[model samples]
Target chain A: MRVVKTGIAGTLESSDVMITVSENTSTGINIELHSIVEKQFGKQIRKVIKEKMEELDISDATVSVNDKGALDCTICARLEAATYRAAGIKHVRWEEK
Target chain B: MEKLRRTMLYVPGNNAGMVKDAHIYRSDSVMFDLEDSVSLSEKDSARLLIFNALKTLDYEGIETVVRINGLDTPFGVDDIKAMVRAQPDIIRIPKADSADDIKAVEVLIEKEEKLAGLKVGTIKLMAAIEGPLGVLNAYSIATASKRMIGLAIGAEDYVTNMKTKRSPGGVEILFARSQIVTAARAAGIYALDTVYSDVNNEEGFLEEVRLIKQLGFDGKSVISPRQIAPVHKIYTPSQKDIDFALRVIEVIKEANEKGSGVISLDGKMVDKPIVDRAERVIAMAKASGIQFDEEDDK
Candidate 1:
């Protein structure tokens, strides 16, 4: 799915990550991540974001995350929320494998 | 099937820090709250957070409960749809006014359980009676469905409905509390008291706990982690009670062996009700981790 508008999800609270997805005219996915635990889990968080974007079938977008030690599941949920908001889709099929 | 619910700690559904570390506090149950604790704009986010937490985190055998939004709200349907898939131990319904309110939610839970390939009654329900109407119909609400295991009082709303606020002496809520406990007892379900709300006032908190216990409440809802220990301590069966129960059990066992229907201890006749109470005492003792020597009398 392609992004229709800017969408944001999550919060800056400890053990949470806020993600903002905006439409990008560029060729590929661009991600900017800011996290306190960047030295340890930065690469892992980036990889998860990229994987989630691919799973949603979005190849081009500007995604940014401000993470505060959130877990992988939390990150995925926020990404899905932001993607849905950006795509302007309601009624998310959450259980679709 | 009756699990210990002495202390249920409420963790805001959107607060990942508290949700992740909730099990460490060792409440008998950790309630992921998606109702009042969450703001309207963040309702969807909080639901997602709790769903993910339930799916990913290991609660270390602590019973997981979720307090969902009321069915009247737009978020309630989706809240139940997401939470049931996560398979919490109990779903607490807020502002439950009658049997219909409970049945409405139960129907949805039944549908979700079937779709998820889970046993139909695996997810239990706990109704929170927070209004005068709910208090009056407490019995029917408690027995509305087979999945309902308990009923809890939410005093904040109840007092508001009563045109008053919560006083330290709890004079305003005595009748409501008594009504709820009686209804729960009549239905053979657990009755849980509301939160004390004053985390700093230890004396007042203890007084409320004592009153609830005296009125025969099974347990209480605790807002902070500091409240868990006191509730558990008060609910634990005393040593004297436990020892008496053990003796009663031993006497009953000997009577059973000899095919004698009549039994007595210290010239006091023991009956089925007495035996049942003794068994419950022993169960409570075991659940509380109190050790006793079985061979002392042997």
Candidate 2:
């Protein structure tokens, strides 16, 4: 799925990550991440974002993540939701994932 | 055994923090709402959030309920499709005025259950009676589908539909409450009372809890974590009552041992109803983590 518009999901809550997916930049996936626990888990968090973006087939988009100690599952959920919203898709094919 | 449902806590579907930590509150059931509590603009976002939460998070065996939007709305069908696949313990139907309204959702749930590789009846149904029409047809709605497990009162809308507001004593919705409770009993399902919106008024909340407990409600829908403890305390059997219940059980067991068809305890006949009540009280006591002697006197 391609990010046609800038879609945002999640909150700045203590255990949540706010995901902002921008329109297709056509230069592969670019990620900018700011996190509370970046020093200890920055690489792990980036790996999650990159893997989730690849899983959703979201190519060539500017992805921004503001993490507040959210878990791996939460980060994946928020990114998938943001990607779908940017793609203007309502129905989620959960079985495929 | 009947499960203790003294408190069913409402957690907003969109709040990731609450969704992750809801089970720690120890409510009998945690209901994630995709309806009125969530704003219109965040409908898609909230649905996706709750779906993932249900699929991944460990609720630690506390019953999970998801209140979906009405089938009339644009988002309602999507809510059902996602929530059915997500597999919460129950899905509450909002504005369920008639059996057809519930059947509409059930049909979709059945189909989704198949596609999701789950048993056809894996997901249960709970109806929210919100208006005078629904109150009148309470029994039908309660028994609408075999998957129906409860009927909950939505007093805010019911009171507004009656052209009034909630009073201090809840006099206006008395008939609705009694009727819903009666309908639920008649249908052999659970009867859940509405939420007390006055979160700060502990006295009033206790009073409402007492009234509903007296009226034979199985539980109350609570909005705050603070409301849960009081409801559990109120639902817990009193020590005096528990003592009497223990005696009743002892006598009944002794009679059965002696091949007696009838039993008497404290000069009154202990019938089936009495035994059932005693068992229920014991169950509640056990649920409250109360322990007493169980050695046989014989």
Candidate 3:
């Protein structure tokens, strides 16, 4: 899906991730992740972000993640929420996901 | 056996820390709130958070409940879609005024349960009678759906709806509380008292706990972890009570073995109601960590 505006979800609280999804005039998905356990878990965190975005069918968006040791589920949750908001969708179509 | 719900701790759905470690406090149940405590703006996020937590976390022994927003709001239906899919032990309906309120939620719960491929009635319901109408129809709401396991009073709203405020002894909400307890008893469901919000005032909290306990309530809802221990302490059967219950069970068993219709203990007849109370006391004793031989109780 094409993101028209900036969509933000989650928080930088402990065990949470604050994510922002915005329009990417450029092609494809771009993610910038800043996490405490970056050195050790950076690859897994990026993989989760990409995977959830793909699940939402969001192929073109600039995603920014500020994670404070969030788990994989939290990352997926934040990513999905942010992507939905960015798509300008008010009611979630849960069946699709 | 009636499940022991001495305390059901309320954990805000949006708080990542509390939601993650709520089961550790050891309350009989933990209710993650997706309504009132959560702001409208963050409703979506909180729902997602709780759904994910319930999906992944294994809260072994403690029962898990989620309080979804009312059908009156925009977020309520969506809340149901996620929570029913997550499959917590129970789904709590807030500010239910009539049987229809619960029926409305049940419709969504069943649909989602079907979609999730879980049994139709696997998820249970608990209604919080928060207004005059809800209190007046407490019996109907308690018996609304077969899935209802308990009815709880939401004193803050009930008091407000009655054009009064909560007092130390809870006199303003007495009628509402009585209706809830009576309805629950009549319907054969659990009567759960509202939360005692004053976490610091031990004496006041203790007084309220005792009042509800004496009023035939099965248990009280607690807010903090510190509150759990005190509620358990009050509900714990005393040594004397435990012994009497044990003797009552032993006598009944001996009578059964001899094929005698009449059962007596200490020259007094043991009636059905007395036996039931004895069994309940034993259940409470065992739940409170009192050890006894199972065969002896039998």
Whole-structure CA lDDT of model 3: 0.89
For candidate 2, give the lDDT. Answer: 0.91
Give per-residue CA lDDT, model 2, range A56-92, as digits (tens): 8876899999999988878888898899989998778
DockQ of 2: 0.61
* Candidate 1 C-alpha error for residue B27, in Å: 0.4
lDDT (C-alpha, whole model) for all candidates: 0.90, 0.91, 0.89
Residues B1-298 of candidate 3: C-alpha lDDT, one tens digit per residue: 5589888999998887788888998999999999989998999988888988888888878999999999999999999888878889999999999999999999998988888677899999999999999999999999999999999999988888888988898889888888899999999999899998888999999999999999989888888999998888999998888889989988888888999887788889998898899999998888778888777788
lDDT of 3 at B203: 96
Cα lDDT tens digits, model 1, B68-178, are 999999988888888888888899999999999999999998887777777889899999999999999999999999999999999999999999998998999999999
Write the residue-wise lDDT of candidate 2 on B1-298 in tens digits.
Answer: 4687789999998888888999998999999999999999889888888888888989999999999999999998889889888889999999889999999999999988888788999899999999999999999999999999999999999999999999989999999999999999999999999999889999999999999999999999999999999999999999888889888888888888899998888799999999999988888888778876657211
lDDT tens string, model 1, A1-97? 8899999999888888999999997878899999999999999999999998999999999999999999998998888888888998765665553
Could you say which candidate leads in lDDT?
A: 2
iRMS, candidate 3, in Å: value is: 1.6
